[model samples]
Target chain A: MKRLLLLLAFAGVVALMAWGFNQAIFVAPTEATMGDVQRIFYYHVPNAMLSFLFFAISFVASILFLAWKNSAPERAQAADAWALASAEVGVVFCSVVLITGPLWARPVWGIWWTWDARLTTTLILWLIYVSYLLLRRFAEGAQMQTLAAVLSIFGALDVPIVYMANRWWRTQHPAPVFGGGPDSGIKDPTMLAAFGWNVLAWAAWGLMLLAFRVHVERRQQRIRHHQTVAALAGK
Target chain B: MSGMNDNSGSQNSSSKNSSSKKSSLKNSRSLRIVVAVVVVLGTIGYLAYTGQASAKSYYVTIPEMQKMGAKAYSSNLRVEGFVKPETIQQDGPNVRFVLSEYESHNPKAQQNPRQITVDYRGSEPPPDTFKNDAQALAIGTWGQDGVFHATQLQAKCASKYAPAQGAATSGAKVATNEAPVVAHGNRTN
Candidate 1:
């Protein structure tokens, strides 16, 4: 049953990824002027959004872990595992966002990068999560969890501020191209359909990765706790 | 007997809490050092990235450019203003014109726009029918010597190019026969 469940999950992820790839790079129409390369938006924007979301969740989970006053070693360990999963996924999504965003920007904005708020905040968000991972490696046990949680909260606070800074200052990054933004033209039906499907596919991909990472984290915690208990017994 | 059991339960809970606290603190000061370093390095790295970005030029409108004056406007610039109808002179391969400046925040000012001269040395401009009074952007440089040299020119194409929502239209390329206004000395090739 376990093997079957794993197989179904893997197949689902593969299907979602294939659909996402088509929506992102294949089926989307070429931009009128840029010609054939504007489809990178589907991957770049979604990954960027997901990276921010994972980090935000890490922050909330950390807060709950610290505040709930749970005394069981298992509870603390589970929270650490969640932190680990969030940090890993956050890093992956941030990397994808960084890479694909530059590819999209080069053709349209005519520069590989700008000092725009979204870009800057994203870089900061990436660093914050990298720090979370490094903190995990260097600090272990209860204190490590507490410190990571505090940092996660701090990092999440930066997201809104970063988004706001774009409007507060001059930005080179294009504003919303779809949705209800003031500059957004009406999206044609075909484009809208592609965008909707891509969003669903991306969500599936993110959830699949999150599930895998969380599973590994739980396993690691179990092993580590067993080792600690063995060591105490030996002493 | 009930009271005794309740007291023992309270003691067990208190002992568990103290034990967890003791375990957490018993981890050596080395853990504290690690946290400090990560926080410090993370903060420094984030600040450095933000600082480098802030030093780069942000996009500015033509009015913003005007406000920035000669000293502050140095990095690659994108200026949007109105095409000055009279200042537009098509000289051979180069077109020279002025962009009428306006506040960057006011898109409504596009209707009664001032003109700026753009000298584009590219292939022929998009089309002759392109409006003389349209909002435009000249993507290039404003020299320290105070002239703007444009490599590209774009006049915002309005709804005139397309048929309204449900109208059927046949495709036919129309000829645009505009008189050439070459500059006095540079009309070769």
Candidate 2:
């Protein structure tokens, strides 16, 4: 019955996500100036925003783990699991942002990528997370946790600088889409409402997925510890 | 004191042994394979996405557009510079014109100043300000005879007006210095 309830909840969320996505896709008209290509903004912008949120989570969890070593091992273990979960989700969103961003750029900028501030910073953030995951896998117990946390916090620091530099650097890509930047392309009430709802829906979905992943991880860790203890007793 | 020291030493040794066993279990072939696959796929996907996005903007200057010959003219491209006076032609829904850099104040220069003629079949070009001496980006195909046939025209708005000049003084005034570029012919539509 518990499993069934969880399944039903997951399905309900998926349906909501689909409905919200359709609202963003169809309700919004092609921009008067940019034409059909502007539709990429609906998914691309939200994913970028959410990716940063996940990266932030990874940084915070890493800090908590490093500072409170004397606390029960469970707390640090939980934080590590959550941090990895967030990192995996973040990497996926970063991938999407990297993809759709170029699609929108091709027709307008005449190139697939630029050394623009936002693009470079996002790419760097992606690389830092990649290294964080690697460090976790290779290092030993306390060392792994400590190194991953330090790397993560430093990486999160880069996000704000990336945003600021994107503004400060002169690039062909327009200003913020959803925000009231130069490209306030969205004036329609239906479109704005749809964008807002979809961002919220996706963010919630991502958090739920992270939670589920962390739960599984913690259970697996407990099983391993129990097995180790049992095997020692047998010996 | 020796008993306590021995117990501490044994505890440390046991913890080290256990951690090494856990580390050995983690370094399995399957784990390595999973990591490799994820990294390889992610990099390839990133490259492909970036390639697709950078394909659209104008890639050449006016002179470069002129040199590429007939095939270059047919491909959709962006060409920049000032719209040349007296060379613009309108026939039915199509418009043909040459864009050239103004030869400065000097009249006697070599090589007829590189220009592109556009065969534009799009909307009526923006007002008189969209004519000679105005900076514009013309999107369309170039013609065999050096015309850039623009399907779309984007003109840079005049930027010299000081805020102090105010709209009341210059807003209502119409430009009457030269004959409008469209005087020669009209669009059939």
Tens digits of per-residue lDDT, candidate 1, B36-67, equal: 76886688567656755653344446656666
Q: Candidate 1 lDDT, tens digit per residue, A104-127?
A: 665444456765666887788888
lDDT of 1 at A58: 80
TM-score of each: 0.67, 0.57
Candidate 1 Cα outliers beyond 4 Å, as residue runs: A69-73, A178-180, B1-57, B67-111, B118-146, B149-189
Q: On residues A64-146, what C-alpha lDDT tens digit does candidate 2 reach at each position?
A: 77656557677888887777778878877888898987876665443467665567778898898888878877875667777
- DockQ category of candidate 2: incorrect
Off by over 4 Å in 2: A178-185, A231-234, B1-189
Error of 1 at A69 (Å): 5.1
lDDT of 2 at B122: 70
Reference-based TM-score, model 1: 0.67
Task: Identify the leading candidate in terms of lDDT.
Answer: 2
